[model samples]
Target chain A: MNLIEKYAAEVGKYLPSRNRADIEAEIRSTLEDMLEERAQAPNADREALTLQLLKEYGAPRKVAESYGAVQYLIGPRLYPIFEMVLKIVAAVLLGVGLLGFGVNAVRMDMAGPALVHALGKLFVDSFGGVMMAFGNIVLVFAVLERVLPLSDQKDLTDEWEPADLAKEQDPDRVKTSDLIAEIVFTVIFLALFNLYSQYVGIVIFNDNQWTFIPVLTEAFFRYMPWINLLWTLQIGLHVWLLRKGMWDVPTRLINLAFKLGSIGLAYAMLIGPAIIKVNTESLAGTSLAEVARELSPLSQFILVPFLIAMIIAPVVEIVQTVIYLVRRRSSVPFPVK
Target chain B: MENDELIQNMVFELRRGIISIAVLSLLGKEEYGYSLLKALSDQGLEVDQSTLYPLLRRLESQGLLQSDWRIVDEARPRRYYVISPQGREVLAQLKKEWASMTESMQKLLS
Candidate 1:
């Protein structure tokens, strides 16, 4: 093989399997073209010249970066947002997983093997699913970044003017107070999680002996740490939005929708069959289960409030996001602040 | 008045608001790595790559900047930076403060 062909094969090792051949062919052609140019030069040694060009062109890693996927926890373009989301998600997922493991271990000690196996499978499935989903998503985004051309490349048309670029920004950009608010909100979430944990301890676990109250309460408490982590990320998103000085109105609405969805889930947990047994046990023979079961399916009396809180609240939040986006856009400079 | 002392104070005061504003404003565009220093310097800020690069990283860790990389050519690549929304808002507010300070300075000098 020629000198150029040798270097091309070496660099091909780093590229994805699908693109490797094409990239190799491109590199091979380029190198051969370079070698032909040097063919007429006085002191050009083919082998040494090939190596010199490769060295200047960079190693396989650098060369591959040109055609490689965007770096992201879930994908290249989505990486930053994905990473921010992952830190929040992973912290919660792992914490919840740990709690699930603890609970299963506890149940194994106290109850039969059947329950233990069920809980174990659930924990494994949940944790494994989350991690796998994150990895797969990053892979997908990296692949997409390779395929997509979403970059801002307008500068190639016009050389950037040094003077205009260097002009100092008008003072009155960035507020420290916003950062402080984010910090304060995150601290509030942390504090609330601690207090809820303590409250669960007093009402359920502290009473000794496993009861329905403790079992269910522990489940909620186990998820509380995850809630705290979620809160931290939510605040982090706020901080990112503040710094970027631009808001995606739809994205904000989506966030509100998700928050409301979660609240809806909590409500479902409260009134659903799952809660009936716990409520009946905790509050004495009033048997909240029997009462809930007896209520008419068409009963809008209770449903109205629940619907208002869950469905209506999110709608209001979406409207608020739209209004906020419009207002901020008017006030803020573009290219993001 | 001492020329050196006056220049020193002027530099310090200019820096007082400028550094934070510049950092915040830069991050508002996109997340970046060490190139931030070069970009700043190329704009005539003359920030030390060592100091500015580390600070950019710190701000990112603090959740103010987001970054990613792109290849401009088949032979070379670079990481890009942008500012977060919160960083933008912060920049806006800081700009307000900076303008007011500049006005006050102008008044005093006049």
Candidate 2:
């Protein structure tokens, strides 16, 4: 390629893919035109003039950047939620790390340098695990940044109204944070249930290493397709709510429909085969062996309440939605200010 | 700041704010990037290629200008830009604002 061709290509590398060719062509044409003007002067050398033209045009990267392409991994519109998620994830990781450390420390019967060394090693290992978790979170957010539609990622071009804020009181307003949290959690559950279901069980430190016990049963896997369908629709709903920025009648009805689906799933899970299983046999010779033996049969007793609550909470929400669909209260729970 | 630096900075600020208005006004006729640059320079409104091209794209994206690439009196293909109907309306308003601003400044300075 010629010097101008090379220069344009370098600039094209930095432009967004959507408009890269057009921009590159424009830059090249402009440079050639400039060079043409300079060449009209007496004794002008074409190559020398081309070099001077490119120099005046500034560096290729700088020229490309002047177009103001979207530069964020997680842009300003999603930044607050990203920050909130990072904080929540960091705290949860720290709590789990400390809990793990305590369990390992309790398992240790040493009282001197051995205990310190083991504790030191455990701390280092936990720190590494936490760092890995943070990296995974960043990866997820980066993917989310690209995966979200341009309409959602970039600030909306629509005319905004201060009156809209006044109308969106506490109950009616869509909290971006709440929708984002819902999306994040639903995505996590989907990933966990589908990709990392084997690691869903209780992990016990045994025989000088960590042993992962798969807690979910085959019955749960049978229901996987249904669960995936519901969760996918649920994520779609959340994205719609995020873009709409408030709940109206139709969205509430849609949400009510999803909640009813949830009730169906919960009812089926309650009546059907077990979803979670604790194999005390797998926990033998570990720190949780005795506890597992005691609690394995009582796992249903622990799980039944949550399933019942899941059914009950959605029922109540459904009732409320029907009531609101009948008549929405005008009273705000508190002052707007 | 040095006097030269102060002058350059102040001139840059003045130029940056009005470049949009000037470009909008000048693009009443369809012109490609280089022709547009020369047109502006001929009228003594100095602007960088970096500034002008991006501004053109931005204004187009904002629905104020329309552009398309076609060969126009040149062997090379060039992206020609013209003021849109929306741009004409905006430019009229901007022109009024500019006139009022300059008039007020003239009064204050006098």
Candidate 3:
């Protein structure tokens, strides 16, 4: 009915139902006491005094918040990591979406309505991607906050030792950028191999029309299961390395195993039938027999050499990893400070 | 401005730490919220009503204080708080700690 009562009611609106009545009664009593003390002055207007006392108490919502226990969808412990992940995901989505739009726009007639249409599509697509990424990330963090155990949560704030500082600053520390790049590439590779295998081809522009000629044959699909497993493993490894913030012996050994597995798969593919379709019918202005002859040498010059390089690259990595492990063993470990 | 803010923050933290002890000491005698607040202010330890009221409820919930409503002559009932046995024990411990902390600080400052 009066200013104090109205203020208490407003504060009670923000408070939980269980304690609202009791808290409101307490606030009203305190307000009355303040009013009584203030009213002892000469010519004290009761209404004016009530308003002044309420103002000093703070906003109704703030008063309620002070009384309530602190609640967070994502608490301070996870906030920095959540923010970092959100930034990376949003940036990647926006970057890739816009890049795709840009390429398509450039291929269109620049002076026509098509370019404007493409620009509009670009805005809408990029906005949708960013929103989806943000929502998914927030949902994940909220779930993590609820399900993460108290002990595991200590990883966010546990004190670091001098040895940790040494490990972080070590010259051989795994580069975050390199690991991130590997993650991105592995994801793209997996998506293309599994989801868009049919679209893996060479685009030839002829007579103002673009034709996508299928380069990879059914033989490529045969290797899909193995390739998918390797790519998924690589992604998991990169994510672990990122969380660890440094690579140790076990990580290097896992990296070595991945390289060895990749080489073995590449070798298997090379020894098998040609993986490229080589559809002679798809060759424009050429007879089937002539096209077939042309494909035989092209496969040798292209596919064979490509497979050999894949094997050689992994062999080189294995040697380097071995050398790194040997060098690490001889070096003195970081002394405790 | 920064120095003033730093001092303000430090003073606030210092006051916050001792406010519970001050409240418990005053509530040794059963008093309603307004009277308890007035009693503290009269002793030169001014506290905001919003802070004091919530703190009283929290202490009560924690079993450090007990409260009951009393009605007088058909007027608005008042909720009165008093320090519990547990509160008295805690207050004694706090006083001992405060005395030792002040002694150590005095020596360090000197």
Candidate 4:
């Protein structure tokens, strides 16, 4: 084959398979055109002219890239979200893993090999969590980049308006960080509640053994369906708020409903049969009756205060929502200087 | 040399955006890849062969241009491109936009 044919073949290797033949044909024709223009001298060798034209055109890969179909595992449009998601997931995973390790280390003999063993476990678990998070995030974004339409992939390419700046300057705009944190925590809570409910308990280290005492009673389990429903709703609300990037009336109303539902669940748990059942016999040096009497007042101290906060927090939110509605209605400009 | 490279790069970017409009406007008269390149260069657009060929395929794919291959009795076959009706409509709109933008920029600079 001649220089023009060789050049076209080399460029074809880099092109997408479906259009390779057509593209190579066009490139060859264009190369001939360039050669004819350059080799205007009467005695110019055609082979030398072809070589000179190919040099000026560019390398095969560079010429192919000019077609503007560069391949990407995760494209620019999805890259920012992918990066943010990976960071948040890694942070949450590392936090939980280290907290578990710290608790286990405290329970172990500090001077012994047990502490070393706990540290090793922490390293392995945290590394595995981070790798899994990265892989999953990349896979999800790759799929999204493939499936999403050009219009939907507007995060990178959308034309900005002055109104967008005004929206950014809005004082009552929803904080993305807060919404992401809520999403992460709600997902963790739901996963543990549904799949690992047994681990959601109190553990005591006594007599060189770890004793996991069940804290939540069957009555608590009974209320879980409603609690799970509310948690799911809250997660949905947070995700929607994240997508919207700002809080409006409808979202606030939805958030108000979620708060009320959560309060109701908390109230039900308070009024129901006792949720924590501490087996006093498992207490290292204490008698059952003595442990029970001591624990009763302590449990009340924790539970009663928690219940009050649950109710009060939602009530305060409801009042605040009403005030915000009134303020918004009065045409008070946002982002007060 | 650095300043020359910078100017070349800026001019390249400026030309890239209008290359489609330029090509579409010229292909109102049917011409193959090589002739079209000659026509554009004659008009002082100076588009590269590689860039022009790919752009023609892309515009054709986007339904803005149509192509057909013709073979004469003693000549190698050549694929010719012509502006579609769709291309004409888009070209008109682009020309209006270009006019308005030039006027606006001129005012701003003055």
Each candidate's clash count:
53, 0, 0, 0
Residue A183 in candidate 2, Cα distance off native in Å: 1.6
Residue B105, model 2: Cα distance from true site in angstroms: 0.6
Q: Which of the predicted structures, 2 or 3, would earn the higher lDDT when compared with the native?
A: 2
lDDT of 3 by residue, A1-337 (tens): 8778899999988888888888888788777766777899999898877777778889998999889745678887667767677677667666755654564445443546756655665565346535644665576567657654444332356464556745646755656545554565466556556766655544332233334456777787899889989888998887677566667788888889999999999999899977875566657564333535454466567788999999999999899889877876877586211
Root-mean-square deviation of Cα positions for candidate 3 versus the true structure, in angstroms: 9.2
Number of the top TM-score candidate: 2
Superposition TM-score, candidate 1 onto the true structure: 0.31
Q: Write the per-residue lDDT of candidate 2 for residues A1-337, one digit (tens) a residue.
A: 9999999999988889999998898888888888877799788899888888888889888888898854777777678888888798788766765665566557555567765666566566557655755666667677667766655432366655556666745677777677777788787678778877875755445455555567788898999999999999999998788766678777887898899999999999999999998877765886778856754676688689999998999999899778865555344454322
Q: Against the hidden true structure, what lDDT does model 3 obtain?
A: 0.74
Model 4: per-residue Cα lDDT at residue A12: 89
What DockQ does each candidate score versus the true complex, computed on alpha carbons?
0.02, 0.86, 0.53, 0.45
For candidate 2, the TM-score is: 0.80
Per-residue alpha-carbon lDDT of candidate 4 for residues A34-143, written as tens digits (9 for 90 to 100): 68777898998888777777888899999989887477897776566667777777787767666655654564545467666556655753465467546655665675
TM-score (chain B) of candidate 2: 0.96
Best candidate according to DockQ? 2
User: Which residue runs does candidate 2 get wrong by more than 4 Å?
Assistant: A39-52, A110-170, A243-246, A267-274, A282-305, A329-337, B1-6, B28-30, B61-74, B82-94
Root-mean-square deviation of Cα positions for candidate 4 versus the true structure, in angstroms: 8.4
- Candidate 2 docks at the CAPRI level of high
Backbone clashes in candidate 2 total 0
Residue A83 C-alpha lDDT in model 2: 84
DockQ of candidate model 4: 0.45
